[model samples]
Target: MDLETVMQELEALGKERMKKMYISNGAHEPLFGVATGAMKPFSKIIKKNQPLADELYATGNYDAMYFAGVIADPMAMTEEDFERWMDGAYFYMLSDYVVAVTLAETDIAQAVADKWIASGEELKMSAGWSCYCWLLGSRKDSEFSASKLSNMLDQVANTIHHSPERTKSAMNNFIYTVGISYLPLHEKAFETAKAVGPVEMKREKKKSSILLASENIQKELDRGRLGFKRKYVRC
Candidate 1:
C-alpha cells in the first residue's frame, strides 16, 4: 500500500504489455505511452495502495495518478501542489469514475469534489461534471451559477464535435454523464447538444449526444413537475 510498491508494480506494467494487442501503424505517430483507459479497471486494487499512487502522480505520469486521487484521495497533495497540478493537467482515465465518486453516497464527497473543482484548467474541466453530478445525486434542490456549467458543456461539446469518431464517443459519454447526473444542468446539456449540429466530415457521432441530452431534458422536466426536484434550468 506504500508508494514504493505501487511504483514497482506500475513500472512492471510497461507501455508495451499494457497495449495488449492494439496497434496503430498508419498514423504519423503511433501509440507511444500508457493510456488512462488501460489503468481504470484496477480501481479497487488501486485504492488499496494509496501512498504508492500519490508517489506515481508526483512523477511525469501524473495523469494516471489522478485516478487514484479521485478514487482514494490522490496521496498527500498539498494545496500548493494541486494548484500546480491543475496547470495543463489531466486525469483522463478515470473521467467516469471521478463523476461517479463525486456523485457517490459518501460523507466527504463534497469536500473531495471541491478540491478537484478548484482546477479551472481546460483539460481538467470534467471535474465540473463531477461537481454537477454530485449535486444532482445528493442535492434535490440544487441551485448553482449557470456560467461554469455552461462553460464546461461548451468546451466539451466543441472538443467532441471535432474529435475522431472514437474520441467523440468518449466525449459524448462524458456529456451524458453531465445529463444523467446533473438535473439542474439538463437544459444546458440539451441546448449544448442542439448546438453541436450534425457531425461534420471527421467524426459522425457528434450529433449522437443530442439524442441523449434531449432524453434527459424531457425526463427531468416531467419528473420535476411532480416534485421529484426543482431548480432553475438556464435557457
Candidate 2:
C-alpha cells in the first residue's frame, strides 16, 4: 500500500486510549496511536517497502513511524539511512524498539550499533545496547564474539550505574540478554549482573524503576530458559 492509504488505514485503527498511553510515554502530536498488533495485516500486504517506509517515518507520526519499521527493508538501507532513522527516533519506543529492532535484521547491525554505543548520547546508547539485546535474542550465539560480549558485560558492570536513565535500562537488559541468549558468555553475564546489581532508572514525572538483571536472569533460569534464542527479532 502507498503512504496515503497506509496512513489512512492506520488512522482508522487508532484508539483514544492508546493515544493517551503513547503520549504518556513521550509521543507528541500527529500520531494515530494505532496498536502495534493492528499493523500486522498491513505489514503482510506491504511486505518490504523502502520508499513507503521512508515516507511513513518522515511523517513524524508515532504510529506511522512504528509501522515504517514493520515494512522497512533493512538490507536496502545503509548506515546513513539508519543514522537518519536514529535521528528521528525521539523516544525509547522508537529508538530501542523500532530503529534497533530493524537494525538487528541487517548484516551491518553490529558495526552501526558499536558506533552508537560509543556515541554517549542517551537514546543512541540505549538503542545501541538494545540492538545487541535484539541480536542476541534472535541470532545464533556464534554470531557474536565471546570476548567482545565479555568486554561489554564488563563495560556495563563499570558504567551502567552512571549512564543516562534509558541507557541504564538498556544496559541492564543487555546483561540479561547475554545471560539468557548468548551461551558462550552466560556465566560471565551472570557475574556481570551480580556485580552491576540494581539500577535505578529515574523517569520524568513517574516513579523510578528498579532494574535488577541478576534477579531477572535467575527468574529465567528457574524457568529453564537459559541460552534461549527467539526465532525472530520483530513481529
- What is the C-alpha lDDT profile of model 1 across 1-235, one tens digit per residue? 5565655555555476434422221111122344556455555565544455445555544333444454444334444444444442333333324333323334444454455544443234444344445455445534445566667677667675554433344345445545655656665676776666454333232333333445554565666532232242110
- The candidate scoring highest on lDDT is 2
What candidate 1 gets wrong by more than 4 Å, as runs, is 12-17, 20-52, 62-67, 74-79, 88-91, 94-121, 126-178, 184-188, 199-235
lDDT of 1: 0.46
How many clashing residue pairs appear in each of the predictions shown?
2, 0
Question: lDDT of each model, Cα atoms only?
Answer: 0.46, 0.94
Alpha-carbon TM-score of each model against the true structure: 0.46, 0.99
TM-score attained by model 1: 0.46
Off by over 4 Å in 2: none
